[model samples]
Target: MMKRNRSCVLALCVAAALGTASLGGCSVGEALHEGVTAVAESASKAARFDVSGTIEQTTMLDNDVLTVVAESLEYRNDVAYLKLSLTNNTEGTIDVTACTGGYDANYVNDCMLSEGYFSCEIPAGETAEDEVDFSLQELQLYGIQKISVLGLGLRVVDEEYDELFKDMVEVKTLLYGSEGVDSSTFAGSIDSPALAEKLEYEFKAASTTAPDLAETDIEIPAAFLFINKDGDIAVMAELRNNTEETLRVQAGNITINGLAAYEGESWSGGTVAAGKRGVMSLRLSSVVEYGDLLFDSSKAAEDADSTEGKEGVDLSNVKEIGMTISTKDANGNTISDPVDVAFAF
Candidate 1:
């Protein structure tokens, strides 16, 4: 994939980020048309959500320099769309940048739609509008429904990508008749057939030791479960953070059946916010390939005759899995000693 520096032509930068044909020095209108076409093409199977036209006009940002409004909400397949209208009130051009952020009870805070929509500039006294798409199915998989609010954290920057404001601006828009969120509405709902089958099997693993609350400030409320997504198995570790700081959780020194397994990092776990529950998922096929496990290839080569037609380490032979779970604070400081967690087949 080709990448462009921020110093490049703004329209071309946006075109590259949006995966659209280069629009050299084109106006914002032309770039927006091309970007929207790319988005629609990426989601060719998506149908228009019925409530798109009913979204209330919510003001996201308003100031002497810029005014932003959440114009509407729409759905493209499993992705949610938030159309924004930005007016540059200042004498100079400005750029708005946004990315995926955390979510709360009311809304899935941020979406994957950044860079492309706001990478271009809004000229002085001119209004630029576009839609940003985010994953709605991921939220549905977590058993959350009846959304009434959508939040966005945006950053205002100058044409040179320098910060124009001191802090990130957050905006929330209401949708779906202001209904409250309820996880019980669809607790076990899964869209993929392979994932549904794994759920029926009810695959779960138990930890042998408990985490020290004084040190870790976290609790495991549920057993680690095997989640099959697109034919890949990811071990889901659910954690509830009780402290008032964001916790970065990861696994190391991992092993399967007493043999070293994939030791690569799985960022699906990411960061869990304070006083909130989140998932730290470790996919089995991290370094090698999906549906394949790490194993002793030298030993396998020695038994080539018996291992004929065998692809990877068989899951049936995986009797136990072990790892050291460590955590860090928001400042990248180690919060607690690594805890060794083990699970038996």
Candidate 2:
């Protein structure tokens, strides 16, 4: 499963689905943005732009026990959500959860934006409708302007917590606006060789220097430096695992211009299987925040006001970047000690 621990994901869903909760006050919204209708009018007005598409009533699962259908898709404030309608045709309540396996949608490649389906319970002979959230960072980072399709995967369980549906059921819903778009050409695994291609493409346009960190079988092939959509300076590092085990890479002790910078969870951990390639995306937004600059500047202003006497790191005047890249095995055992590296643009 993809690592999803964002603090405001729920709040984004709530503010967008219910058309309530000040985006400023929303810390977490209910995971399932269950409401009576789709595309709350207030939500469309609150978002930066509305998504013009339609998710036809597509049946994802149909059997003796349950029936699931994707009813709609909506995009608000860089977050995308698909409204779902589930009918519990059985005699008991059912639990629906998000497991693994994902699909790529138009403009959102690799489906990496998936935050997992919201867990919910449906009473017997009743129908439940809810919304599942997705991030649009991938689409924004690539400068994509439209979305054509939304794909999702889910799992169903019985009231006893037993597996009613053992494996993930994949659903691909075609949005009306994607009539002529071909999604197959852009969808693939996040750790595939395509990551290398993507990094190289960005490198050709933005990187002043691409440095490789020396390690035994692992190789750092491409590192592209650019300003992400959020206006934060970011590096898309591509790695190749030549060894025979799945390698997980992370960064620590990061610094920009010799000042302590925020070290947060990477967008991609660069987890790669043996003989495969992957990406690890790192960004320098603000020294105080943990994640990228996803929120507005008002939040930063609040933080600044609270820490009046403390010195602040200046990201706008960056001269050098330094960090220790560490690698570990699937079991979380360190494969090698952290190596200090520096870069200049």
Candidate 3:
């Protein structure tokens, strides 16, 4: 009976051993499968955030203008290093989840994600740091010509995380051109009044004309007579040759009106040469006060009709005057038609 019991015990022990070996082999296979899956998942995650380090050889186009260029970008393996310095200029503590940065041509609405680019989250009134690395192959496939750094994304834990970060926060992207040089910074606000003032000044300066002299001779008619706002009257009875050489004169006379207080004070002096006409300013000492000056067109017409022997003529009623100038050749012969000047007060 003892021998039979020993044989049975040995058989039972062998069966138990075989069962244990089979279980161990199955466990090993399961572990190997799990290990492979974990490795693959880790590789995928690494590829997603592969953007690391700095972009090199960047070029900036039209520094002050809207155009910018990037020559080259550099990265550490497949990882990108991003540093953000944020300041809360607002009154309240602002929580930010993510920020975006990229090339904006219009700088208004057109912003696109660059290669291997993504958004992150930041806390209100607190600075946050993030490290990202993406797949090299994916980065090239995205055709990312520029970069935009963004914040706020689907939270890893819960959907409520979306409201944690608001888009009110400002982001200043310090981009280095392909040459590894810093580009100009741009602000997002607009000051319309200031811009308008600058534009006004630019137009004013452009409209002001400089004095120019005529390159040819000019002539004047005998009927040309002028009275200025200052009450000064000038009558050209004959041609006055002030130059030594015989030169042609273009017809024109400068006059001033001294009687009309609102006309202000003006004067002009220059020599008319044989083949050149001099330009002079008819400036007013002060701008005429509005509503203080009166003009009489009837008196001007009367004066225009008769020049007989009028001296110290009362021109207070004169609202307008006419003067004519005709250019003459070297021999004092009239050239082209006469140019007329009409003055109104």
Candidate 4:
């Protein structure tokens, strides 16, 4: 009886395979139909620009046709300055404009002129030098975590006609930190094979601990947590053991916008040693959309202070807003309890 049962199973499997093969069988006519369908789909969508050009960096601006290369960048306190050189290659005169656009440490819009963008016109066929400056406060306000120079726009004009050049040649540069002052200049010619090279910048990672704040002895810092441009909410807290002895601790819980913390898949866990500091990074998934974390001008204006006859109030421009944190002991006991960090904008 066992042998008969095994035979029946094998036969069923063979029959199923045959049925599947029959359903998937394709004839010559079917293949031709599929080819025509694919051709029609491809023909419906096409690109508008023929992006088959090259990019290069240069240091000399005298040659009418040229690209600018950033040679050095430095930041002190909160101000940042970028030094760059331009080169001209064409025999005829070429007019050019350049600028910087990217994010700062706080991931805010820390572009040139606080607008996170810059533009400057270069004299025809003349290689010029220039610098772009920005504030650290503006960088932190926008949560700008990175910066880079993408390309340039050029315009050529004659008595009879004029032409606008957009991204004519790509210029690549290495982003160095404040420490590295003696570095090679980023420059090259357009359409050259060497223009494909990219300059890399180094970043350092660091962390710090805070003083413990228990229910009876807790003192909240005068700061507000906000939503970041990446749609993440962050609240920083310090924990310190005032007592002489080390205290055993466990994970702290946080609540925001009526939603409980430690409920998401990206939850953090760890222990805090006595006299040592720890950080808690939390996100408010329930209250945030993908790109709504950054400060919006409309929202800030609506929440601005409305005191009569007084100077307009400026709330903290938070990259990440509206967050709070709470702590717990090793025995699963509540700490100072969770508190909401109010957001004004």
Candidate 5:
């Protein structure tokens, strides 16, 4: 009797699976398909951190030559990623130096020496897809409502445009900063109003008002020298810690005489032991046509020697080196007020 009961049960299960009975009436193929589909849907949901509804498209122009379009910015695994594309319409390449990525208005960059992105080239008459990545795990931990990426400048490398000011190739910035249009020798005209506007922007930024570091506790115990040696110009200074505690001095967004001396890199800055001193310097390199100068201190140590007490350092018609050096604490939080130390030349 028991064997008869077991045989009846087995027959009923086979009938249901074969779709011959009303008990859930599913075929073997149908059951297999449904099970696989359910598993796939769950795995698909688990794979992605959804930002489909969060991203927005943005368009930015780089000196009227290159167009940068950014979209689908998302963060995962401590890296903030952006889908960016560049279309270069002009006849030259665009030297994109940096892309300032921030959360809300907060610049996630702790030390001003953030190389947002560099050495990335966009050739003319070409469209290229670029991926920009930034590490922002701390920002995520603190929480973020929005993400913004800006502060991008492109150096247009065109032979035609460069030829327009061949006479000013070496001393263009020095001339412009010292004499502006009055020094008509280097201030040649560009037919493109857009290019003119961009030049004007750079000029204004590089030669802004001199900073007043008097309000801050930081001090430069020695006179800073703008030196010329080995075909390189460098600024050497001593960062003196006036505070009772140690200081991690950070200098970024550096500009000199209305031009970018150094951006996206620390300029003449470092840590000073409690009431002690540290070396701060910036070694500069750039095309002079842009009517500005920049300083890179992170690499200044390599070029620091042979510049000490160097008599050949030129200071003619000099103005100021606009910079902001901040003092950071043990937790990397900015503990003191920003030190706007625009060393006058």
Candidate 6:
């Protein structure tokens, strides 16, 4: 599959981060088309969430009137992502122009997705299976969350979407009557019972135990899942830019939950610079056992018996992970042939 344009996506991130009405005042629907060439590309990043057989948060709305399977939610860099499939078994097509993924009882905070319709459609009896990338904005990336939506009515259908946001950021559709009356309504929040359930369901996915990654020009040579010396749970990857040209790492993410932010400003796995070798440290959202995060192929045989009898922590839970490293050159051309790197502990 081909990748989406990167420059356009970063532009949207800048607009959303700045809270501009039109991608910094370019107008809502227009922004989605222009920037989506970039954002929609992240869905390719969705493959990183392919936890094979793990069934995470599978919830139904109004007894399957709308069923949603939140296949997985992982934290990469500073973004909170929800890779899900929502089926609309209701009466008519529920056009979700925009969405607010509300994670709390009170809708005070959320990862707002105004360009959702560009990515998918739940046209009555159909399912929209696309990964949603939510900007952390003011929310914590590692917490359990829900998806919500709001949008507009079309008088003049734009190439990007039906209508514009008009700076209306409310989840008004949660009230039901607002759907067809000129604009979109906020789909009501789906409240879960407990936080622990949210955490377990969202992150439960099939993962690799001992990763054997193929070689790439940009490679993650050494990976570790360990409590850093500073006492924070961390995923440290030593990335090397084997290419001779100065390939800039456009974005970096280690999707395993925990580790809210990447350690540095430029590269998450430390600056790859023009040279080939460097280390990138993703600070975990929370702390984990020192041993579990430190396991790999060679050490597994020795630690197998030692980790089994250990109480309190479950070493089996620390599954292997897939790392995504995107890079580009001076000509704005993307470096291709991506191979999965592993932090198989």
lDDT of 3 by residue, 56-113 (tens): 4333222111112233334565333333333332334333222121111011011211
Candidate that scores best on TM-score:
1
* Alpha-carbon deviation at 116 in model 5, angstroms: 2.2
Q: How do the residues 128-216 of candidate 2 rate in per-residue lDDT, one tens digit apiece? A: 88776665534433323345544444566787867676333444445434544333212121222333232221121223242455563
Candidate 1: residue 195 Cα off by (Å):
9.1
Displacement of residue 258 (Cα, Å) in model 3 is: 95
For all candidates, the clash counts are 0, 2, 78, 44, 12, 21
Tens digits of per-residue lDDT, candidate 4, 1-345, equal: 000011111111122222211111112222222211111222322211111111233442233345657555555543455455655455555444422211111111111121213334444455556654444332222222333332222333332334434332223334323222212111111111211111011111112223344542323323323222122223333333443332333323322322232332223333333333222333333223222333233433455454411222111222223333454453445654444343221
Superposed by TM-score, candidate 5 places the C-alpha of residue 41 at a distance from the truth, in angstroms, of 41
Between candidates 2 and 3, the one scoring higher on lDDT is: 2
- Badly placed stretches (over 4 Å) of model 4 are 1-64, 91-93, 99-125, 145-161, 168-345
Stretch of 10 with least lDDT, candidate 4: 1-10
Ranking by TM-score: 1, 2, 5, 6, 4, 3
lDDT of each: 0.47, 0.48, 0.25, 0.30, 0.37, 0.33
For candidate 3, give the lDDT.
Answer: 0.25
Q: Considering TM-score, which of the candidate structures 2 and 5 is the better prediction for this target? A: 2
lDDT of 5 by residue, 1-345 (tens): 000011111112222222222332212222212211111111221112122223456665543566667655666664556566767677776544342221101122111112234334567788777655544421221122123222232333454434111000000111122222121111121112232232121111122233555444566644332221112233444445566765566676665554444554244344444554444545433212122333343334344354531222122333556667666653356765655556554
Score candidate 1 by TM-score against the native: 0.56
TM-score of each model, in listed order:
0.56, 0.45, 0.19, 0.26, 0.31, 0.26
